[model samples]
Target chain A: MILVLVETDAQGATLVSREALTFARETAARLGDQPVHAAVVAPLEESMATLVMKQLGEQGVAVVHTADDERLTTYAAAAHAAAVVDAVRAEQARMLVAAGTPRGNEVLAHVATRLEVAMAANVVAVDSVEPLVVTRQVLGGSALEEMRLDDAVAVLSVAGHACDPEPAEVPTAPERLGYTPSVTDQDLVARVARTEVTVVDDTAALTGARVVVGAGRGAGGPDGFKDLLELTELLGGALGVSRVVTSLGWRPHHEQVGQTGSRIAPDLYVPCGISGAIQHWAGCQSAKTILAINTDRDAPMVTKAHYAVIGDLHEIVPAINEELRRRK
Target chain B: MANVLVCVKRVPDTAGEVLLSADGLSVDARHVGYTVSPHEECAVELATQVAEATGGRATVLSVGSEDAVEQLRNALAVGCADGVLVEADADLLGPADVAAAVAGVVREREAGGLSYDLVLLGNDAADTGDFQVPVRLAYALGRPVLTGISTCEVQDDRLLARGDGPDGTEVFELPLPAVVAVMEGGVSPRYPSIPGRMKAKRAPVETVALTAARQGSGRVRLKLPPSQPSSVEILGEGPEAAPAVVDLLTRIGVVGR
Candidate 1:
């Protein structure tokens, strides 16, 4: 059986978790029609648990094992990992899968550690099932690597949006069981003490936006972003920055789009005054169209963009904003 | 006083394009230079700060060929006081193997009466993007571990780690003798001073031979993701390009005509 770790929110199932379930279903098909089970490790209310189980059932999960403990009120990597690991053992799972989110990777890493097994992160494709060959993203999604899991149980995480979620052909109510994970005091040591929401919840906006306007060092300073902000608002899009902008404290970390930041798949990516380095390319490579406006035509962003204008962004951006306003 | 150990990997400077070797097992680094990942650079910086605040010694370690000593020395030049190189064929070792080697070293050091109060590593390697070593190493050493932490400080016997969570900035507290996998961007890494470089060049790095069991990522080969060939269309220059840009945006339905 293939066991998947599902992450839940107020909406019951996160998008990436749904995507993971889809990936698992395909993997199961490739493995001679093995059953796919899911484990949710959170302190969910009874009503919420039922809803999550129903959602999982729709995605073709045969059984939904849930582990809810008072100690798991918050996100703790080790505690959650212990629960997932227990589920895998109880079910005699041959493979463990999860979404490649920060929490997902951390929890799965912990499980892999405890089990003394090898884990593949950000896997995108399943090549063969007998030897368990898979392809995964490396160098922050700028490259791909084909790997084989030679462990007793293969542990891996599907990269975000590797496949879209689809409902099962014959959706049936899944069997729900409560699991009790034996966790030690050491497992709770590195848990989240508290969370401070600093920003105005712009993370989703940036990732979900149809258009994203990226700013780089050419923005000069924090004050230089005024025009860009106006342009973003006018275009009904979100603003993103390069790693250097965040390192320089010109923008918040959430606003940065790069290897260590958010990976955006916007329809149109307008990089103003940004030189597209490999790090930044990792985050924006999925964009459908790229339009670069820079002073240097040879800049990586400009050279790689579908459309390029060799000009100072300060002048070009304002002019474009003006044209947009004039059109409106 | 606390003793800190920061582990760094020697990866190709990926600021430029990545090219694969003919065998596809590794990156073709014949032309490209190598550097530690940004996250590890930040880890080295954090280790230095914690050591300074607690009057401790910061040791840098790497598990790779002798050439990896360059990365260890870079960390030493920045702030690390000591260095250790676990000589191994890194390409053959998996995260589990690397974790075992690191755990062995930590145990040996503890037996020698020199224990590390804290161990630091990059959140993920720039080359392989594996996010397992720190957590696996922590488990092998029977220690608590935190991943993707941007900033952290030692407060008495507890370490305070701050990172970005789904809701907001999550703060984590772990006791001493913990492992932290640092993410870059919280703190700026410092440049090496002349004296620091001279001192690092003279610093003796302890070498340990590694016999790895290589139950790892089981990587077979690497291939570049197919990229769309781009032929950039010049849309005029200067502010004169604005109207044409808006026209294209309208054609793409981003802006209605």
Candidate 2:
């Protein structure tokens, strides 16, 4: 059996968890239509849990095992991992899959260690089931690696957006089972104590924005971001800056786009003064269209952009803002 | 007072473009320079701060070929008082194997009456992209683990960790002798001064032969993803190009006409 651990938010199962389900469904089909199961470990209300299970069933899950202990009210890697381990044993799962998010990867790592199995992170594809050949992203998605897993139980996390989530042709009302996780006091020692939401600025918008305007070192100084910010507002998009800008203290780290910062997949990305280095490219490579404005035509960003304008961003950004205003 | 251990990996400085080797087994490091990743840099910085705050000493360790000593010495120059090199071919080992090696060191040090109160590592290796080592090591040592922490400090007797989470910035506290994997951007790594460099050069490094099993990641090879083919259309130059840019934006539906 192939089991996927689904992560849920207040709304329901997250997008990445759906993507992992897609991967799991395809992998199950590849393995001669093995049963695909799902395990959800969240401190969810009864209604919310049912909603999540419904979503999972629509994705072709045959059995949905849920952790029912009230002690798991917060995010703790060890306790969640123990819950997954219980589900894995109950279902006799030979393969475990998860989304390659921070929480997903961390939980799976703990599970793999407890099981003493070899696990891979950020896997993009499974080439062969036997001997377990897989392709995964390495170097923060800057490169790809083809690997083989030598463990009896193959454990891997599918890279984010590797495949789009698709509903099963015939939805199955999955059999639901409540599981009691075997957790210890040590497992709860390092759990999340609290969270502080930044009300002053909503940085989550940048990750979910359909349109993003980027600034690099070419933004000059702190005041240089004014034009870019204006253009961002006019386009109804979020503003993103490069690592250098954040390092220079011209922009906050939350606004930085690179390997160490948020990865964005926008419909359109307008980088006004950014030099598209590979580190920054790692974050924005998923953009559908890129338009670069810079004085250096040979810059990496200009070369890779769908459209390029060789000019000083100080003059070009304001002029573009003016044109946008006229059109509005 | 605390004795902290920070683990760092030496990776190719992936700046503009990354090129693969001829056989595709590893990165083409023939021409590119090497440096510890930004995450590891921040981890080292955090380790130093925690040690200094507690009037203790910070030690650095690396499990790699001999070339990794350069990175260890770099950390020593910054603030680490000692260094250890677990001589091994890192390319041939998986995260489990590395974790076993680190766990062995921790056990051996404890036997020798030198115990590390805290262990630090990068959230993920910039080159290998493995996010399992710290957690695996923590499990091996039967200690608590925290991953993706951006800011951390020792508060009295506990470790306070903060990182960006879905709802907001999540905070955590763990007892001493815990493992923490840090991401970059929360702290600035200090540069090595001349005197610090001289002192680091004279510091004696304890080298140990790796005794862990080589459970490789079953990595067959590496290949660069095909670049997106594009023929950039020039939309004129200077502020005069604004109209053309706006036209293109309208064409792409970013701005409605």
Candidate 3:
């Protein structure tokens, strides 16, 4: 069995979890069609359970394991680790995979260390020989390294937001499985603090959008971002911000792209007044096409872009908006 | 309290557009000078804050080459009284092996019977950005962990952290003797002065390297990041086209159905 552990919240399953599940399902299909276990820490209320399975099944995941023990209620890395360890042993897990999000990285790291096994993190793809080989990015996005880890039970953390969660058009009814924690006092030590949760207004979130219009510090601020937003709506996409723009707190972390932030694989990435830094580029490196607008002709970001516009985004953005409107 | 062990690395300034060898894989070390990684600096800052609040000793550690001592001295300047360098030639090893090398250092620390409260690391290396080390090291030490912590505080020996979660910003509090990967801006690392630098230079630095994946893993290929193509398409008019644009807007799915 291939265990694909998912870290979820009221915001639903994270992009990374879904991506990992997708990867796992593909891997399973490759390895003689294996079973995919989608584990989440939640009370198995019928609707909630159905929603979780629906999300996973859409991505080719079918098996479902829910850890509902109150002790497993919150985001306890140790508890999750412990629970996963038991599940792995019980299921005789062939390989363990989770999307490479914050939680996925931490929990898998612990499992790998505890098992004294090697882990491949930030894996873009996996190739198997006598031992399984994984390809992952390093040094932000500048380098790609390949390694074959030789362990019966291996764990991998997939990249976050690598792929948007697309619910399978044909919903698969999830089979509910229960798990009891084999976690010891050591596993239970990390305090899992529960707090009131608030939801993100993703109405404008750029996840999986066909087009993303991004603004940098030079767009000036929210006003420039507003122009970018206007353009996005005109283009049928979402607005994106660079690390600088988000640090200015002009936008939330979700809209921010970088190694330390979200990774967007949009069809088109339009950068405005944003000086592309290596960190920021890592998030959008997977973006299909690039369009940049900057006043500095020699700006590095312009060079990284598929199309560059050397002009003031302030004047330039409104003009593009007008042109798109005129064309309409 | 958690026995936390924080790992940090020294790296050169990456934003300067430094070029690697023609193979384009390894750093053209002659030109670049090393500095404490930004995320690692955050690691030191966050560890110190948590240690101060929890009354635990925040032990700082690193793995690098001889000149890496210079990097260790930087951490000391950040107010980590003591530092250790698992001095190794990390030029060729992949992250899994690097994790093993770091795990050896932590094992030595544990065998020495130092009671750790937790283990922490920058979420990723500033230069390489591989995030496996902390979790690997933590697993080697058999502990739980947290990663990408943006905000952290210690209360009653439990570490409360706020960071980028899957959905949004999620909060987590875990008991001590764990691992954490610090992110950017979590805390401001203090600046080192002439005296701090001088004092750090005098302090003894520990150097250790476990056996790593051997030389010639296969020649690595280096190439510049693929170039993006772009052009500036100047629009016809400004706000006057707002309606025309707004009309196009509904067409694009932004303003209307």
In candidate 1, which residue ranges exceed 4 Å CA deviation? A45-51, A199-201, B231-236, B247-257
Clashing pairs in 1: none
> Model 2, chain B: what is the TM-score?
0.96
Question: TM-score for every candidate vs. truth?
Answer: 0.94, 0.96, 0.80
Over B124-217, each residue of candidate 2 has an lDDT whose tens digit, in order, gives: 9988887899999998898999998989988777889998777778899888879999988789899989999999999878999999888886
Please tell me which model should have the higher lDDT, number 1 or number 3: 1
Range of the 10 consecutive residues with the lowest summed lDDT in candidate 1 chain A: A198-207
In Å, residue B117's CA in model 2 sits off its true spot by: 0.3
- Worst lDDT window (10 residues) for model 2 chain B? B248-257
lDDT of each: 0.89, 0.89, 0.68
State which docking tier applies to candidate 1: medium
Name the better of 2 and 3 by DockQ. 2
Q: Which digits, one per residue and each the tens of the lDDT, describe model 1 over residues B1-257?
A: 78899999998887888899889999888787998888999999999999999999899999999999999999989889989999998888888888889988888988999899999999999989879999989988888999989999998988998988788788998789899999887789999999999999998799998865667558899999887676899999999999999999998989893
True contacts kept of each: 0.90, 0.90, 0.31
Of candidates 3 and 1, the better by DockQ: 1
Sort by TM-score, best first.
2, 1, 3
Cα error, residue B98 of model 3, in Å, equals 5.0
How do the residues A1-328 of candidate 1 rate in per-residue lDDT, one tens digit apiece? 9999999888888888999999999899888899999988887887988888888988999988888678878888998888888999998899999999888999999998778778999999999988888999998887899999878889999988788789888786889888788877777888999988865657767876889999999999989999999999999999999998888899988898988888887879999888999999888877888999899999999888999888888999999999999989
RMSD of every prediction:
2.2, 1.8, 4.8
